[model samples]
Target: MATTTASVMGPHQKYAFEDTTSLLKDINRLPLFMTELDPTDGEGGSNLALEALQALAYEGTPFEIASNFKQQGNDCFSLKHFKDAAEYYGRAIAAILQNDKKKEETSGENSTDKAELAETDEHGSPLQIIDNCGPNADDDEAEKLKELVTTCYLNRAACNLELKNHRRVINDCAEVLKVQPRNAKAYYRSARACLAIDKIKEAQECVERGLDLEPQNSYFKNLAIKIMQREDYLLKVQQQNTQREFMRKHVVRI
Candidate 1:
C-alpha cells in the first residue's frame, strides 16, 4: 500500500551517465578510425597512440599546420638533424602552397589584382607587393603567410647546405628570391650552393646581388672573393687544357 520511493539519481548524475555511455561508444569506434588514419603492421599501443596524436595535431588551418611544421624544422635544424629538418621544411612549404591554392580557388575574382601585384620590382619591392597584395592592402593574414613561406624556404635552404644538397639549396634559395629578392640570406645561400657546384658565374651573380642588398656583410664580401678566385682558377685550368690540346695536335714526334 506504500508509494515507491523516487529514484535518487540527480539530473547531473543522469547527464554524467549519458556522457559515459557516449564516451564508451566513441572508444568502441576508435580502432576503426585509427586504422583509417594509419594502418599499422603490428605496431605497439604507444606507436598507435603517437600516430593518433599526430593526426590530431595536423587538424588545423593550413597556416597553423605550416607554422607547426616550420617550428619542428627549426628544432631539428638546431639539433643538426639536417635530413629531418629538410623534410619538415618541405612539409611546411607544401602546406603553404596548399593554402595558396585554396585562396586562389575561393577568390578567383582577385586574380587580376594578384597578377598586377606580381609585377613589382624583384629587389626593391615590399613584402606586400611581392605577395600580390597592394601596397595599401590591410590584409595582415596574407602578409604573415607570405613571411612564413619565405622563412620556410630560407630555412630549408640552410638545411640543404648542411646536407651538401647543393642543387636543392640553390632551388630553395631561388624560391625565396622569387618572393623576397632583397633577402640577403637567400642570395648568400644561393651563392654558396652555386660555388659548391662550380657554377662560378652564377655564384658571382648571387654574391653581387647579396652585396647590393647588404654592403657591410662580411660573409658576402668573403664569398665574393672566393667566387672570383674560383673563376680565376677555372680560367687557368682552361688555358692549360687548351695549351696541352694544341701541343698534342701540332707538336712533332721524335
Candidate 2:
C-alpha cells in the first residue's frame, strides 16, 4: 500500500520498489506467465527481463554485508541478511563511521568506536555462503566462523577481480578451494584469472579440476575449450617467433 501510495502521490517523479521474492511466489500460473512475458518481449525501450533481473540480482548493499561479518575460526553461526530497506539504513551508518575509525586508527587516535568494531569486517558472509545455510554451521558454531572468513575472502577476491587483479583473484580462488574443494565456480573463476595473467599451466590445471568435478557441464567444457585455444595460440606464436629469429640470424647468402 505504501509503495502504491508513494507512486501515485509522486506521479512524474515517482520511484517505487517491489520484493522480487514475493512477486515470483505469486506467479505460478501459465496464463499469468504469458502476461509476464508480454512486458519482457517489448522490443523497444527498457523491458521486463532487464527490470526483473535488476530487482533480483545481487546488489552491493554495504550494511547488509557488514551486519553479517564472520571470524575465520568459528563454525556454528547465524547470517541473516536484513530487508533491503533495513540494510540500506544500516549501510548509511556503517559508511560514515567506517572512515572515521580508519583515520583514527591510522593516526593512533582513539575515539568512542563501537560502530568501528562492528564495521571492521574481517570476512563478509554474503561472499562465501552458497546459501544462507551452512552444512557444519547448522550444528557446530566453530565452523560458522570459518565459513564467514571464507566469505570475506570471496568478497575481496571479487573486488580484486573487478579491478583486473587476476593474481589476487587466483589467491582468493585458492582460499575458497582450501575451504570448499568442490567449488566449481571458484575453480572456473580462478582459471579465467590465470588465463588473463598468462599463467597457462595454472589455468589448465584449474579448468581440468573444474571439469573433473563436473564432467557433463557444458559451461565448464566451453571454458576448457577456450583455455586450450588460448594456450595453443600462445605456443604457436612463440614457435613462430623463435623460427623467425633463427632464420633471420642464419640466412644464407644468395
Instruction: Give stretches of model 1 more than 4 Å off.
Output: 1-46, 100-138
lDDT against the true structure, each candidate? 0.70, 0.52
Query: Model 1 misses residue 25 by how many Å?
Result: 33
The numbered model that scores best in TM-score is 1
Report the Cα lDDT for candidate 2. 0.52
Give per-residue lDDT, candidate 2, residue 127: 30
Model 1, 210-250: lDDT tens digits are 88888999999999888889889999999999999999999
Task: Indicate the residue-level lDDT of 89 in model 1.
Answer: 74
lDDT per residue as tens, model 2, 172-242: 66766876899887888798888888888998898888989999988778878888899899999999999
Cα-based lDDT at residue 62, candidate 2: 30
Candidate 1: worst-modelled 10 consecutive residues by lDDT: 110-119
State model 1's lDDT: 0.70
Query: Where is model 2 poorest over a 10-residue stretch in terms of lDDT?
Result: 71-80
- Cα lDDT for residue 53, model 1? 60
